[model samples]
Target: MIIQMEGISKSFSGNQVLKEVAFSLEKGEIHALMGENGAGKSTMMKILTGIYARDSGTVEVKGKQVVYKGPKDAERDGIAVIHQELNILPELTVAENLYLGNEQTVGKTAWLKTKEMNRKTEETLRDLGLHVKATERAGNLSVGKQQMIEIAKALMTNADVIIMDEPTAALTDREIQTLFKTIRGLQEKGVSFIYISHRMEEIFSLCDRITVLRDGQYVGVKNIPETSFDEIVSMMVGRQLGGRFPELTNEPGDVKLEVKGLTRMGEFKDISFAVKSGEILGISGLMGAGRSEVVETLFGYRKAESGQILINGKEVQISSPIEAIRNGLGLITEDRKTKGLITDFSIRENISLANLKSISTNGWIAKKKESALFENLIKRLRVVCSSPEQQAKSLSGGNQQKVVIAKWLGTSPSILILDEPTRGVDVGAKKEIYTIMKELAEQGVAIIMVSSELPEVIGMSSRVMVMFEGQMKTILDRNELSEEHIMHYATGGDKHVG
Candidate 1:
């Protein structure tokens, strides 16, 4: 075995997160770690990477028992981790970020060997099939590109065992293919990987063995060839998920929002669509197909060069987020960590931020009313947190998403625009979010959702709109929705359907 952890236990403020969990990885093997958010997957991995010390356990690397004091120590012992959240400094160049702490020095002086570092960074990027320049600013690159840089950083360590947490969450399908190729190449070179991802397809395709964790306890491990996807999901969720999406009973009502000839030059042009009250209009397309751009225009985040927006059959001008909110429109942005929530603030503060006017009287805040509002939202959304005062960043990815939903729900908008609502959440959380959308639709709120996952779009949408190369290819009804059909239009294979 390349790595083995047994009888691991950990807790935070008397709340047990992991309870005697056991895991093992073999040399040159791609092992999958499956779990829902807050299921102790991150905690277990953190312990392995020396970010957290286990309360009780034994960790052995290559048959040698060792305890690392920090991440550097773990890296020295041939273990490296690519965290879910991007960890590169925005101010630094790609090469600088890659060799951050382990910089090359010239002749024992404090001066750095800039040329050597850039050359090594270029070599690593080329090896990984990433087309980013070593001297380019990290912040200027797209999320997908930044993700590649993170992988390159991990590979630079030359570790025998690597832990990847949601490594492809921000990547496009093409980038994902490149990553898979890289993983296979590394495996051929005798490097092992502990892959953590919620996407079942990725696990089934890349992993040799799968280990399940639930509520901070080890469930079981199975060989990829012997176990089925349904069985794995049942183990992680502790119950059968009856369906991928809930059945919609509520019918769409009269038009609540309509966009006509919305144009943004190169981003998107002549975009037109209408969403009725109690309807979910799904926007589906490939990455950079201008889905986000169109939605941002509707939400007042981007200026529309020429367009007409009508709410309740009356034209309204929405030039900013504040204006959109005041006009009864709410947007749940795609990138939740950076664009949606204030990570440093408490849950109560975030939930109350959107609708401050409703919770305030005479320009003075109403403390009791605010507390009551937050309490109700917390219980309604099933957000798992110790208290309302807990920082938003402290919650798991699933819980943070719920908080984002709650923040918008607080505004009591008639139209809600959700962009990749369940992007990084778990299946259980996805189900809960779908349920919430259904409930909200039943309450007469129109929903316009933008998603990259075709299953999600087809399953939840009343109608799916396909976009290709910044133009509307087709709008598919429920009866016409299928992965092949959607992809055909999204990839510009067909443009005549409506």
Candidate 2:
């Protein structure tokens, strides 16, 4: 065994994240940590890396008890973590980044050996089978390539135990395959890994053993080949998944929105799509492929230089989100923490934000009416909170998303746009969100959803539209859309798509 964690428990403020979570890693093995969002996987890893101090636990790394005060302590102990968010200075070159803090200085800082450092950087990237130029700026690379650089940096530091959190979340099929090959080679060289991710196929295909967590508790540990996905999901969920995506199709009525030649200088160009009442249209693409930009433009957050927006078949000029809202459009932005909710406000306050005018009576605010409305919505949405008075930030990520959705529900817009609605939500909350979307559709609400999860787009969407590098690619009927096909089109590989 390479690492053994016993009775590990961590708490944030008063909230318990990991409760007696126990797991182990073996030498040269890829152990997968499976759980939904906010399930304490990251917290446990942070404890190991000393980013967090565990409330109570005993951790043995390499058969020796370890106490780490910070990431540097963990680094010296041969443990490294590559978070989902890559930490890199954009303006710096690859060589400069590789030797960022520990730079070689001649004569105690008279000058540094740029040529020598660049040569070493070239060797490091080449060792990973990548041709990334040493002098190239870090921000110039794709997300996939940037992830590879992060991995290379970890290796350059001579880490024995590597914990990769969602390393392939944004990578393409080919890039993922390349990553798998690299992982296998590293494994052969005696480096162990703990991979945390949500993709079922990748977990089974890449991991040696799968450790499941549910609601901050360890469910079970099973060998990869012996355990089926159905069994693993059952363990993680603690109940059988009875049709994860509920069947609640509503008839798409008259067109609620029509966009013609929607253009925004260099963001997205000549984009055109119409959404009808009760239809859930999914938009998908690589991270920077203009999926969010197009919808943002439609919502009037970004001005479209050349576009004719027809809501309910009437042309409207919307210069801002307020104007768009007045024209019956609602947009749920991608990032909830920074953009979605008012964390300082109570649940009721956040829920009633979008329709303050409607909730208020005449010139004065109607407190009773607002409370009654939010109470009804709270029960309907199943927002897990102590009460309506609870702060929005006190709720979980999934609940926060539900609150945002509830807030928008008050607007009663003819068309709704959801950007990465289920990005950080757990499986159960995700199911609830799907159910709510279906119910809204049944009630004749038009919804446009942007999701990076291919399964979400394919499963929940009545129709799917793909975007590639600043342009609309192809739109497919639900029956015709597959993960592979959507990916092909979204990445500008029409040859593979058709």
Tell me which residue pairs clash in candidate 1. none
Q: What is the lDDT of residue 274 in candidate 1?
A: 92
Residue-level lDDT tens digits of model 1 in 1-498: 989999999999999999999999999999999998889999998898888999999999999998888888888888999988778798899999999988999888999999989988988888766767889999977566788899989987888998999888766555677789989989999999999998888899999999999999999999999999889999999999878799988989999999999999988989899999999999987766788889888889999999899999999999999999988999999877887999999999999899799899998789998998898888887888999899999998778989999999888889999998887788877888899899999999999998877778889999999999799988888899998899889889856654
Give TM-scores for every candidate, taking all chains together and pairing residue i with residue i: 0.92, 0.83
lDDT of 2 at 399: 76
**lDDT tens digits by residue: candidate 2, 428-472:** 667878888898888888899988778788889999988888888
Pairs of residues at least 3 apart in sequence or in different chains that clash in candidate 2? none
Looking at model 2, residue 111 earns an lDDT score of 94
Q: Once superposed on the true structure, which residue ranges of model 1 sit more than 4 Å away at CA?
A: 102-136
RMSD per model, one decimal: 2.4, 4.1
- For candidate 1, what is the lDDT? 0.89
After superposing candidate 2 on the true structure, give the runs of residues whose Cα lies further than 4 Å from its correct spot.
11-16, 84-107, 110-156, 168-178, 341-355, 361-403, 491-498
For lDDT, the strongest prediction is 1
Whole-model lDDT values for every prediction:
0.89, 0.82
